[model samples]
Structure formats: C-alpha cells, structure tokens
Target: MAGEIPRAQPPPAEPDPVRDAHPYVLLWQWRRNPLRRRTDRLRAWIALGLALFVLLAAPAAMYAVGDTVHRHYRSTAEHEARTRDQRPAVLVHDAPRHPEPGSDEARETRYPVEVRFTGPDGAVRTGTTDVEPGLPADSTVLVWVDAAGEITGPPLTADEIRSRTMGWALLAFLGVVLAGLAAHGVAGLVLHRRNLAGWDAAWADTARRWTRAP
Candidate 1:
C-alpha cells in the first residue's frame, strides 16, 4: 500500500475566456470581484443613467416638444382661417393652352387664368391667378382673398396641420436621440481616458518597486 502510486486527479477544466468577459461588461459594477475598482462602478452608474435618459426622458421630452409645436400650429392656423376669406370667382377668358415655360404653373402644375369677382367695395375686379388647368370660360373657382379683395394664401387645412404635427414629432424624437448618443459617446471617451491613465500610474508604481528590490 505504501509503494502504490496515487492516481493524479483529473485536470481542472479550462475556463472560457469569452464567457468570463460577460457581454454586458457594465454589469461588473454590481458583481463582486477583486479587480472591480471605484471608477468601474461609477462608469456603470453613468451608463445606467444614460440608458434611463434615452429610454424614458427622451420620449417625454419628444412628446412635450411635439405637443407644444402642434398647439402653436393649430392656433396659428385657426387664426388664419378666421382672418382669410374664400370667394367665388369666374374665369373671364379661356386659360392659355400653353403656359409660360418658367411660370408658377410649371412648378405647381396649375395654369394662370384671368378671373373676375366682386370686391368688398362691390365693384367688379379682374386679375390673373393660378388655377386648375382645362377650365372653360366662365367656370367658377374659389379663390382666397383679403378684405381688400387682394389674392392671398388660404389657411392651413386639417390635413396640413396633421402632417406638420407628425413632422415636428419626428424631428423632436431625432433631436433627443442624437443628443443622448452624443452625451454617451463623450462620457465613454472620458472614462476610457481615465482608465488608461490609471493603468499607466499603476504600471509605473509596479516597475519602480521591482527595480528597488535587492
């Protein structure tokens, strides 16, 4: 029995390097480890704060901004509608079969037609304005005007308001996201630099002690 050789215990299994480095390295703040430093914990909290701001505060801010813009647009549109007037106008003559090459028609796809309408002063007035193409002579079309019968732009419609609201909302969302990303990027850069500086100091101290050893 004394001369019998003891069998060697099975070699310990090798730990996986990748699994040891967890995917969510920031979670190291909560994990107990001798290597986890105070800076690491601070960085983890900063990361958590960034995540909360992106997930929660960003949406809240976007909603607030969108609501404010929507309300303002609605109020302005309502006011414009109240102040502007649309009146029936008749084409005084047939619109030209071919419009000018570089006229508003080319852009808006509407032709300029001569039209006549009664002004607020009760006098007949005539002017040429952009209108739908292919209209016969004396066809009635509604045109926006001011109290002086001067042609003006119509008020924003319900559809326009809705479209504007959506655009503003999208812009607000993008603004928040970009700001959050920028802040996170800057914070990460600063933390990385701090870690590198700490490493340099630690290495210097270790080398100095090694040199001093007899």
Candidate 2:
C-alpha cells in the first residue's frame, strides 16, 4: 500500500447545472449585458427608421420635383411661342436679299419679303412672310420663328408641350433617384459589415472574460 500509487482522486465532478438548463440561458445572458443589448436595439431601430424614410419619402420627393420642373418648362415654352406669334412685323430698307440674274444693274428693282425690327434694347429681330411673293421695301410682313430658328406657321399649344416635357423630366428624375438609392444601399451594406465586426469583437471579449472568472 505504501509503494502503490494512491488512486488518482476522482476528477472533480463538472457542474451539470448549465448543461441541463434551457437554451434560453444564452439569450438571457445576452439581454442582460448592457452594452451589447443596448447597441443591438439601437442599431435595429435606426436601420428600420432609415429604411422606412427612404421607402416613403424618396419617390414622393422625386415626383414633386419632377412635376415642378415639367410645369416650369412647359409654361415657358408656351408663353414664348405665343409672344412670337403676336409680335408685329416692321419695315426696313436695304435689307439683305439674294440677287436674281439677267437684270440691269442700274435699273434693278429690289423688293423686301422680310422686315427687321430693332428692339428698344437695340436687339435686331427679323420676320419673314410666305403669303406674299415679295414685300415692297418699307412695307410690313408677318412671320414667326420658333426657338430653334425654324419658321413655324402654328405655335405649339400648352398641352402639347407639357406632355413632352413632363415625360422627359420624369424619366430623368427616375434615373437620378434610382442611382441615389443604389449608392445608399451600398453604403448601408458597408456600415452593416463594420457594425457586425464590432459586435463580434465585443462578443469574443465578453466570452473570454466569462471563462476567466474565478
């Protein structure tokens, strides 16, 4: 008996309290940790609110701005067309003209088919007429020119211009909003990844401390 090695003391019985406990223990532990619990809740709520705001407000804002821009462009185009139609033709002498051949230089008669009007601000404006073969010099003729410098017999109506302008504006607004949403989603993903990394680090730290306890 003296020579025989004493039987190794039975290994200390491992605690079975946690082994039999419900899985809810882990959940309760996590919930009780102030820092971890608060951070998780705050992050969740913040993400939810941001998502809701983007979902609801983005389309509405885009629509409102697009409508405003469309209306503005349409009104401006229509008003300009009307004003051009109403402007009276003026008479001028020695207006530039294309020459015809086989005419005597000394007795050649020149007639005006267009007139130029100088505005009060010294801007020279011109009009042309197709109704008359030639407008006599110092005589008036009526004509209309559109924004693109092409002669127009009838100006565009408000409704016609609005339809086209609204279509273009809405298309552009949609493109912009979609691009913004895409960028926002990418940013959110990056932030979420960083937050996840932080959470993992905190979890590891907590676990290490728990295991090291006396």
TM-scores for all candidates: the values are 0.67, 0.37
Give the clashing pairs for model 2: none
The C-alpha lDDT values of all candidates are: 0.75, 0.55
- Which ten-residue region of model 2 has the weakest summed lDDT? 6-15
- Cα RMSD of all models vs. native, in order, equals 11.3, 16.7
Q: Tens digits of per-residue lDDT for model 2 on 73-104?
A: 77776776665553345665444443643446
Stretches of candidate 2 exceeding 4 Å from the true structure? 1-43, 85-154, 168-187, 199-214
- Model 1, C-alpha of 167: deviation from truth (Å): 2.4
Error of 2 at 24 (Å): 19
